[model samples]
Target: MNRQLTNSKLLLKPASASPALHRVLTVPQLWGIAVGLVISGEYFGWNYGWAVAGTVGFAAATVLVTIFYITFIFSYTELTAAIPDAGGPFAYAYRAFGPMGGFSAGFATLVDFLLAPPAIAAALGAYAHFLNPDLSPQWVGAVAYVVFVSINLLGVRDSANFSLVVTILAVAELLVFMALVAPGFQLKNVVAHTDSFGWSGVFAALPFAIWFYLAIEGVAMVAEEVKDPRRSIPRAYLLSIGTLVVLAIGTMLLCAGAGDWRQLATIDYPLPETLAMVLGKGSVWTSLFASIGLFGLVASFHCNTLGYSRQLYVLARNGYLPAFLGQVNERFRTPHWASIVGGLIGLGALFSGTTDQIIIFSVLGALVMYIVSLLSLFALRRNEPQLERPFRTPFYPVMPAVSLVLALICLLAIVYFNLLLSLLFVGLGAISLGLFWRFGRQRINVHLTTLGEAERH
Candidate 1:
């Protein structure tokens, strides 16, 4: 009773004292941010699926994954427009299932956002190594972490501008790559190169296929900072996903058509290598490909680091993590502490070294969030029908229902192929939830109750 009374007193704290985030991003900046966050997927990682499933099999898996993402993004827009919080999926899950659900969604989002950069950083390292062959890829990745994180810490506008520049260059590089490879694209290459794995290979390829469109949902994380979220968030989400889908399909086709899909499947820097095959090794085009290709990886590495920091900030703000991780820098007006901590974690993960491993593990976390979030959509519709929604998902329940089912199918396929990673993901999630239940609940309960009281007062 004494503890409850004390909690009530804490819950009565004034709303004016709460820390606030800056609102500075617009729709175009959000396009840059969203595309930049996932464009690296188009450049690398997805090719690895060819090794597992062959070109046709990988393409099949990609088609399926694309459906899931399209539906998922359309449905996700409603949530973002309705509740524009940096917490993204966590914000939706929290409203539908309360504190425990929020932590789970937030934790899984952390896993997705945090693990992705090291993989992209490793790709950046590989690109650097391609140019000089002397600089260690690991060290190059470490340097990238330092440089991009510093840019992000400087300010959100600076970070968004940097992302815009890199994203354009990255897109331009892909266009150049497609043009160079267009002459060499023979229909026979894809048919002749089909691996023995066949249909089963499609299932094995599911996680890698996801690389084509992964992390695009990250746009929602910045809804809090958007100038007009209801209008802007939905536009950004649809446009970015549409752009990515066209690019993913075109890139995959051109890549397989240009050379033996078998050889392209295993390399870290597939684009330069594909260019080398078509334009000749050591040619100026290959070198240009190597140089400009870094921008694609850089764009993703930089933007995702930004996403991870905001996620950490959201977690801390909700009292699911340490309060210090939630602090916005008065000088830069960014989440300085959260960015630094997330960078340190990404830097430490550089030692993992395997891009595919990091990517598969990261997808597992996203899969969990996808499941919970789709359920949240259902829960919210039933539980809070009166809630104001500026943008409604077209097709109502069908879009989310299809997205949820496809997500589950993809998750199962990925797990079937990656048993060890799936087990590790489950173990980590379980342990984290156990710890949160034991201790973090008190803080979250107090925080939520306090917000409610403040609103009442």
Candidate 2:
């Protein structure tokens, strides 16, 4: 067995269980998923209220958050280009910290991915209120989950196509709304009305602002599917982040200008409400537009699940997870079972409660993963100087360091705002890490031994 374990084939060959699926996602589609998930107008209105009340200026806060996101994407693009693998942050963590760290990162990501679909579905359900206020939120969430899951289960090609369509419609709607409302923008609204520009408001608004800037790395999750990952991944990251920041600033300006900040703060769906007031009941178009945005959210959720499932499949093939999860659907040429599992998790989250709780939990988990990923970038650079890096992080250690710091700040803000809930999430991740180390290590060892025996013969 020792001799067999030394065999070059056993050491270097790819796992038989892992098969490359269709690479159908274009840079645009990747951008769509990243932007769509994070660029919700409703979230901005809901959370930015406090920011408006406390910050020196809404635009300044937007700019600060956007800069942080820009730094994050740069770091992510470099990492994704170096390791264009399915596991994303999981792959990075494994390379930098080892199996335990990898599993923790993957587990955290899974928590976020599992919660995202349902949270977005519930958000979509809320937007459905615009179309038909009587529509049951639960049912709306259920329907959206089913529809997107179906699209996802169909395979990557169809899912990417659907995402592209939703992205186009959503962007167009925002542009049109901006074009119509830009003329009515009032200069007075841009002025900071209160004396809330100190550390208190900045710290208070940081979490929600970070939430708005979240999901910028969703495209990195599908790094393997990108046609020219080295180039496309970075391009998509920049384009998506840039576009989202612009849209956010534009929407904030338009909404603030058209209506009082206090009024916008009180609105459940600020954009639509502002539009309705400015453009009349027909401006209720914000609802349809928001529905489109929700559609984009569903698309993003599907793509996210698809990307993460493939990551799990790779980890399973590596003996870090159950081997059964590594199996691919020969018929669909996708990770069908994993996709179904993701859908079920989303369904459960949808039934759990309101969108806010789901978003908080999902954000908490994602921030943990992001923090680890950013740290991994520095660790890998220090430990593996000879590693082939197709694309180096442009700002090198500085950008990644900044990203790590910002991620920590965001995590702290989450804890500060939602103390008990944040503690619960951290506790859950800690328990998961303990379980993976205690039980998963033994299984991986056994699998390794079995592979060694097979190689020896």
Give per-model TM-scores: 0.95, 0.88
Prediction RMSDs, each to the true structure: 3.3, 3.6
Worst 10-residue stretch by lDDT in candidate 1?
7-16
Q: Candidate 2 has which clashing residue pairs, if any? A: none
Tens digit per residue, CA lDDT, model 1, 1-457: 2433332233223222345666888888899999999999988999999888999998899999999999998888888888888889988887777776788899899999999999999989888998998999999999998898899989888888889888988888888888889999998987775747688899999988888888898988887778989899988888899889988999999888887778889888898888888889979989888988888999999999999998998787766777788788878878888999999988888886488999998899889888888898888888778878988989989989999999999999889889998999989888988888887788776765665576679
List residue ranges in candidate 2 displaced over 4 A.
1-18, 41-61, 190-198, 266-268, 282-295, 319-321, 450-457
- Give the C-alpha miss distance for residue 169 in model 1, angstroms: 1.3
Q: Highest lDDT among the candidates is held by which one?
A: 1
Q: Write the per-residue lDDT of candidate 2 for residues 173-288, one digit (tens) a residue.
A: 77877887677778676554656465555655554555566666666667666787877777777888778777777777777677555655543456666676667666556556
How accurate locally, in lDDT, is each candidate?
Answer: 0.85, 0.68
Clashes of 2: 0
Candidate 1 at residue 8, lDDT?
29
